[model samples]
Target: MRVLFSVSSWPTHYSSMVPLGWALQAAGHELRVLCMPSQTAAVAGAGLPPVPVLGGVEVAVHNRLSYVREARAGQWPYPWTPLHPVTGAAMSTLDEFDLGDYLRTDGARFAAASAAGHDTAVEFAREWRPDLVVHDPVSTEGLLAALVAGVPAVLALWGPVGTHEPAPVRILPDDLGDSFPRHGFGPFGPDLIRHVLDPCPAAVAAPVRGQRLPVRYVPYNGPGVPPGRLPRTPGRPRVCVTWSTALSTMTGPHSYALPAIVAALTSLGVETVLTATREDAEALGPVPATVRLLERCPLYALLPDCDAVIHHGGAGSAMTAMVTGTPQLAITFASEQSRLAERIASSGAGRHLPGHIATVETIQAAVAALLQDVAYQRDAAALRRAALDRPSPVDLLPALEKLAAE
Candidate 1:
């Protein structure tokens, strides 16, 4: 069987699918990754064949435009229009506006950006004639190509299911309506997505729609040298601090809280290891002597030795910490992230702090609680076991094979 995988330009989104691609290749199936031209190097680094699409354009262009538009309009970085109290309560107990806002802003923008690659991907799919196409949710081009080619398509989720209230494609702006018909499909709906491969552990995941296939969460932090044997301070707890690589680039420097985070850790006198790219690190003018900063270091390598992790609430960062059984303090600014952070806190494995309220004192308090409390550590261990107990990507081969056969 030939399998084609499509993902967005973001590293976190695409990296989540690498292990599954590897699984298909190992099972004697041919595989090729369809991604933005900018992401070709990253896909290749993961040891998969990359077929770059979207010409030379990058998705970040649209994101930057949206950011500027929001800023100019005096809206939140990524604003959610509040629903009426009566309507909001009627929708569901949890806030549905976040998902609605995501579809309006990020989801719609992503679809527009991805539409640029639609013809290119369809052309590739027609030539390669793969039996199956697996794609992350935002990669609408993948589904379009698969539909055009008359092949089965699986929706692989990065974390928990966030598009449950309204099907993602259904809520897309009308400008995208034409793209669907061009591929011989009507407005996109749940039927177009054959399966949802969920990696989030049940304890922290939102209830999924459609056929749910549970897959173990595997952490792939791009290609990087392992931070060799971190030396621990005797009897002192070590904490890892990371801001997601994409956040700063999307929202700009004003969103950075690492300096405040480090200050809090220093006040508590816990050993702190800060990991970031050179660009992100350079944004921080100077580093204090108390903090050890490593550039381009993989979290999988750094998190195991640390007792707790403080991060911007990115799915990759949260899951990496979870798989390692490290407690977390998630400082989130966006709606999707805030939702995930809430789930993490409720799971007994971590704490969530809204970016607006994450002051130095509060950060310091959260970190100290994670370190001193035995419940957090114990719960984190349980969550780790639950995640590991899920089916491995290779184990899902039979199911995919059956789908392709049908």
Candidate 2:
């Protein structure tokens, strides 16, 4: 079978689909991952064949978030009337949603991702004629490509099924005005996806809606050599402190919070390993002499030896700790991230504080609680078992095949 995988340039997003993509490839299916050129090297590093698509998600998302900031300032990014951009996609005009703020933020995000590679992937799908196309929920271009090619398209959700559903937004590029009729399809939305794959463990995940299918959350931090043997200090409770690699790209209110968190952790006599890219590591200001600051390492490789974790609430980082059964403290920023932190706290596996409100005292308190609280440890361990008990990608292969066959 021919399968095309579409994802945004984000590494964490791409990592979510790696295990499933491998399952299909191992089953003898012809697979090619479609991503922007910025993500090409990382995709190749993951040992997956990457096909470059046209426009880049970087330009798209950057502009979209700028639009969000404008909207928050009470400035309208779009004119009273919509303008025909080069892609001929509508700007500022949006459909009715539960929140008007959502229309500008998530709406812009989806449209940007859709606009970036829509035409390129569609042309490729039309020519290559794949039997199936699987895509990240945030990157909806694959659906357009599948629609154009008249192939089955499935959604591979990156996080909680409920949290990751594609926002209902119309990204109808001007060039594709009459394309739907030609492709024999109507409007596409989250509800239109007949088969949706979810990897969140049931213990922490909300109830699945629609035709959602469950798969085990196999954690992958992408290609990197193991960080040799960990020389964990004797008799010290090790705490992994990270802003994640994604933080290097993040321009958030809490960007400087890491150094404070690190200082507090080390002052408490806990060994703190601060992980991030060199650039992000430098951004953390002065690191305490006691903290071991590593600018790079696969988080999964580091979590196994740790007793607790402190992180900005990137889904990949939080989920990695959860799967490894390590208790955590999440400094959640954006509203979307705040929900994940809340969910973890509700599950009894971790504690979370709002990023903007997290001071040295708060971070120290949260980290200390996770390290000292036995309930958090017990609960995280149980959740890890729940994830392990869920079906693996190999077990999910038959269902994916059945979906494609249908």
Candidate 3:
């Protein structure tokens, strides 16, 4: 089977797809990944064939993320107040923090992005006629491409879907753009996805309301040689503080609280590794002696070696820590990340500091809790064991093939 996978330009979303893409390639299937032009080298780095589609909306993505960060910081809202009645208790899926105008703004943003990417995708898929199109949940363009190409498409999840149990899916829009015409096709729904591949462990999984396949979270930190840096185990409890590279790469690094976090953790006598890009590292100015600044490392390879992980509650980072059996400290800035953090904290395996309110003191205290609490370690181990039980990507091939056949 020829599998064509698509994603938004963000490396974080692309990172989740790598494991499954590699699995498909290993299974004697031909695979090509179509991403925004900016991610071409990254796609190649992951050892996959790259199809750089036209009309890359990277600037739009950057602007949206920047807006979300600013909104979370109370700098300004996304055209409206964020505290809506729907925002009660549930975290935004770490999607772009849309403030209050979530549906219309987000819908329009999706439509615009889809319109930008869909035509090229449709043209290519029409010619390629791939057996399957597995797309990042955000990229409905891929789904339309699949529709026009007469192939099945699956929605690959980075986190749990937003809907609660007994998911009531609505009809998909009649058209995303000129390319995706819904007149001849059957009814579509909000996401327009036929299958969902969920990677979160049951302990933290949101209730799945639709057709979902359980796939193990395989950590892929892009195509990089593992950097060798030993965490000072047996000497002092080694704690890692990190932010999602996507957040930093799209917006700026979390400049406000990072240095303070380093100082407080180092002062607390714990060895800390601040894993960041070289640019972000330089952005931090200087760090304490007790803190090690690793500019680049394969996070999946580095995470298991740590006693605890502290980061911006990205599903990738959080699950990496969880599957490694390391306790976590989640300093969440967005709604989805905040929810993921809350789940980990409630599970006794980690602590959370809302990024909006996260100060140096809160970060220091959360790290202390993650490291000192035996229950955290114990619960982390239990969670890891549970995560291990999910079927691996290779193991899901039979089911996926069946879907493709249908």
Candidate 4:
């Protein structure tokens, strides 16, 4: 079977798809991934064939202000943002981009490019006739195109879906939850937040509503592993701190309170490794002698070797730590981060830190507790055992093969 996977241009989005793409390919399915042109090399690097979509639109001007700030911060525009610099600029430059007056008004060329990408994807699928189409949470255009082509589509949500469980989901909505009102408004209207929550405005979930789609959760920007191997760690109480690399681009290294965290962890006699993009490492200022700065080490590699994990509470990081039987101290930045933190806390594997209010003192105490507290470690082990009981992607592949045959 030929499987077509679609995602926004962010590396975080593509990272999650890599394992699945590899699995499908291993299962003898031809896997092709569609992403923004700029991400071509990245997708290729992940060992998957790249299928360009979105008409190679360059939507940089719409986010000129953000781009300037990012440039000043030593970062460039990536498609992690909603009205992403790339997509917005594409909207401005294209004649066919249409998401209503708001999206199209940005520019004619941008509009054309957006529409062209979606239309082209649909036409491509009609001609190519892939057996299955998998879309990322934000790929509204791709989802629509798949629907138009009458192929079975599954949305793989890399982040929060916003709506609570039990809510009827017809199509994936693009709601960014309740944080929009907090940020200033201009081109990003309130609807932009709502739109992010459900990207597929027209998807009807009649046959699919209660039937859950396969949401294979993996880390956003995971440690690029060494082939078939995890990272090597020594015999000591290890502490790991990780955060979204994308956030490093928007805000500076999330350094409001992590320094205090390091101080506290050092006090606890724990060895720490803070992981982020190399750019963030410099922006993060100084690392304690005890704290290691890692560029790319598989998280699962380090988790099993750790006593505790700390971070901004991304779903992938939390789960990796949990599956590895490591307790967590989650310092969340966004609404979804907070939600995952809450889930971790409720699950008894970790605890959450208040947004923006996370202090070094609080983080220090949490890490201390996580390292010394037997209950936290016990809970982590319990959850890890539970996770191991459930079918991993590797275990489920055979079943999917049979389902595809049916």
CA lDDT of each candidate? 0.76, 0.69, 0.70, 0.57
Model 1 worst lDDT window (10 residues): 166-175
Name the top TM-score candidate.
Answer: 1
User: What is candidate 3's lDDT per residue for 139-214, written digit by digit as tens?
Assistant: 6567878888888888787754343322111112234444445424554454456677888776777654568888
Which runs in model 3 stand beyond 4 Å of their true positions? 54-56, 59-113, 161-188, 229-233, 246-255
Best candidate per lDDT, number?
A: 1
Candidate 2 versus the native: TM-score? 0.81
Give each model a TM-score: 0.85, 0.81, 0.82, 0.72
**For model 4, what is the error of residue 55's alpha carbon versus the real structure, in angstroms, after optimal superposition?**
6.0
The CA-based lDDT of model 3 is what? 0.70
In order of lDDT, best first, we have: 1, 3, 2, 4
Give the poorly placed runs of model 4, Cα more than 4 Å off: 55-112, 159-210, 213-236, 251-257, 398-406
- Model 2 residue 169 lDDT? 19
Query: How far is 281's C-alpha from truth in model 3 (Å)?
Result: 1.4
Report the C-alpha lDDT of model 2 over 142-215, residue by residue, as the tens digit.
Answer: 87788777778877766643523222112212222333334556654445556667777765674334476788
Q: Across residues 262-360, which tens digit of lDDT does each residue of candidate 4 receive?
A: 777888767887766676567668766778877766676667667788877765676577657788888865444566577677767788886456666
Error of 2 at 344 (Å): 1.6
